[model samples]
Target: MRDDMDKVIVERPRRGGSWQGDGRAWRNSKEAGSHLGMKRGYHRTKWLNENLAPLKRWLHKQVHRPWDKVYAELCSGIDRRSTVQAHIFEHIDDFVERGAVMRDGQVWVSASWWGRGGRAPLEEASHVELFVHPLTGILLPNRRLREARAAQRTRHGTWAERRGDKPCAVYHVIDENTQWHRVDGCWFEVTLAKFPERVDAAKREEKRYDVLRRCMVTHGGAGRRPAPDMPTHASLYGRNDVYAANKRQLGRREVRARLGDDA
Candidate 1:
C-alpha cells in the first residue's frame, strides 16, 4: 500500500446510444396489453419486421441462445441494454472513480459473449503494473512508477518550447495572454506567474542578443542611419532592459559603435 503508485484507468468497449435504444425497443415489443398480461398496442408485428427479426438470426449464433427464449428473457428484463448485456456496464463507473478493482479474488468484471470484460493496454503503452494491498486494495508503487509520476508533475520544458521562439507582437498581447502553453507537445493552461520561470536568466540574455542582431540587420548595418520610423539598436536594447545593472561590461565605445552612433 505504498502511496507512489497510481491506478490504471479501466476502459470498457464503446457502445453508442443507438445500441441502447434499439435494445430497449426490442424488449418492449414483447409486452402484452390488458390486465398486465394482455397485449398492448406495441405494433408487435411491425416491430418484429423492422427491428428484431433482422438481427434475430445473428444473435442466436452469437449468444448460443434460441432467439425466442432470449427475447422472452429480455422482455422480462434479463438483458436491459442489448441482445446480450455488456458485463462491464455493471461496475465500470464505480471502478473508474475508485481507480482500482480487487485483483484475482474480488474482480467484478467478466467477459461477455458480445465484448471483452475490459480493455488491455496496447503493446506500445507505457504502463506500471504493481501489486495491490490485500485488505485495503491500495496500489503499491515501484521505482519506475514513482519516478515517472514525479517527473510528470514537476519537470516542465524550456521557455522556447512553452511559448513560441519569437517575441509576440505588442498588438497581439491581449490575444496572446488567452492562448495556452505547450510542454512536451501537450498544451496546458499556465498562469502568468509560472510562465516566467520556465527558462533561466541566461536564456533571457541570449534572446535579447538575438533580437538585437535582427535589429542591426533592419538598421542596414552598423554606423548607418536608420529611418525615423524604424527601431534603432539603442531602442531595442533599452526596451528589453538589456544588462541595465552591468552596462560597463560592453563599454560605452563598443555600444555606440554597435548602435551606429559612432558614424
Candidate 2:
C-alpha cells in the first residue's frame, strides 16, 4: 500500500540479464505441475541444503506445510542470464522498474512468503527475534510485484494478479529455522550460518557485525557466560555485505572470535 523506499542497492550495479521468467506460465510451474500431477524444482540445491531446508522443516511442523516451497518455485521461474543469476538479489532492475523492491521509510522491503501462507518461523533459533531499521525497512512495492507478475504472465496469462499476489517481506530471525516470511513491516534476514560463498558475499560482513553486536554489552565488553544453548555466536551469520559495512569498525578474525577462538 505504501511506497518510497531505499535506493540503497549494492553500490556496484548488476551486470546481469533481465528477470524475464515467471513460473506461473511455464509449462512446468510447480502449481501448474501440481494440477497435472508433477512437482516443480524450487531453488538451487545449494540454497536449499545450505540455507532454506532446515527452516522449512520447522515451519512446516507448525503450519502443516512449507510455504517457501511455493515462493522458491516462483523465484525459480524468474529468468536470468546464468544459473548464478537465479539469485533474488540480481534482479534489481525489475525491482526498480516495477518498484516492488522499495525502501520502507529507509529500510528495504519486499514480499517474502506472503502469498504462500506461512509454514512457521523457525524455533530453537539462536536469536529469537530481529529488528527493522526503524527508518529503513526494505520492501517489494506494487510495481515490483507487477513486474514479477508480468514476467509470470508471459505464460500464466490465464491467472490474475489480485488472485495469486500477496504482500510479504523476508525476516532475519535465528534459531530453529531461517527462511522467508510474509509479514507486514520490514524484517531483517538474520542468520549465524557459515559464510556465504554463493554471491559476491557482500553480506557476510553484516553477519559478523550481528555477532559482535550480540556478544558485547553496550560498552563493547564480552559476556561472561555464553548463551545457555548453542555454540558461541552460533546464531550470527557471516555474509559479505554485512561484513564489508563494518570492516573498518572490526576485523574478520575478531568477529569470528566472538563466535569463539576456534571459529
Candidate 3:
C-alpha cells in the first residue's frame, strides 16, 4: 500500500496546463518553491489525505466491503469539514472511473456540492457508477440505510416509538430502579429508588384509588369522597370526549335496568 501510494505521488503531473485544472496547480506553479507555496501544498495535502487517501485504497481493490467497515476506516480521524467534503466530491469521479460502487446501502451522490447550488452535469451519465454522499462523504449504495439510520437515531434520542395505531413515549428500563426518559428533547437518567418519598407517595396514591373505588361501590356510587376529591368531569373536553358522558359503564345501574327482562 505504501509503495503504491508513493508511486502515485511520484507519478503526479509535475508541470503542465493539465496541472492548472487539478488540485496540484498551486503546488507546481512558478511560486511553488516559495515558503507560501510550500505551506499551501502542505495544508492541502494534509487535509486532503486525512479523508481521501483511505478512500482511494478502499476502492483500489474494487472488492465489496461492508458499509460500516468502509465507514469506520474512512471516517476514523476525519473531523469532516465542508472544504474537505467538497474536495472529496470533486475527486469522486476519479474513483468512479476505478469501478467503485457501494456493495451495500445507498449513496446520495449529487452534482451539487454540499447541497449548495452548483453546476450539474448536462446529463446524469457520470453518476451511473459511484458517487460520494455530500453530507457524510461516505459512499452508500442507496438512501434507505442512511434514512433508516437517521430515524433510528431520532427514535433513540427521543424515546418515542410506534405502538399499535399511535406514537407513544417509551421508557427503557435498565433495572428495577433505573430507566431512561426523554424530557424536552433530551434523554435523562431517572433513578426511582433514590426517591423513597416519591415511591411511598405513589404507593399511597394507588391505595387511595383502590380505597376510593371500594367506597364508591359500597356507597351506591355516591359519597363525600376522600380528601383529594376526584374531578366530577374532565376539566377540558377533547374532540373525542364531548359525547363521553353518555357512554355505558358496566359498573353503572343503567346496564342492569336495561337488562331487567333478561335477568
Predicted candidate 2 versus true structure: per-residue lDDT over 54-165, tens digit per residue: 3233222332223345334434543345354344334323222112222333323233322133222222111112212222332222323333433444444423334664
On TM-score, the candidate that comes out on top is 3
lDDT of 1 by residue, 25-91 (tens): 4445556332442222323322111222223332223243333454344335323454333332343
Summarize candidate 3's per-residue lDDT along 114-218 as a digit string, tens digits: 334533331222332344444344443431333343444555543334333333243344455444433333434444321112345334322122221122211
Preferred candidate (lDDT higher): 2 or 3: 3
C-alpha positional error of residue 258 in candidate 3 after TM-score superposition, expressed in Å: 99
TM-score of 3: 0.21
Best-to-worst TM-score order:
3, 1, 2
**TM-score list, all predictions:** 0.19, 0.17, 0.21
Query: How good is model 1 by TM-score?
Result: 0.19
The local lDDT score (0 to 100) that residue 159 gets in candidate 1 is 57
What are the lDDT scores of the predictions, listed in order? 0.30, 0.30, 0.36
Candidate 3 local lDDT, residue 249: 17
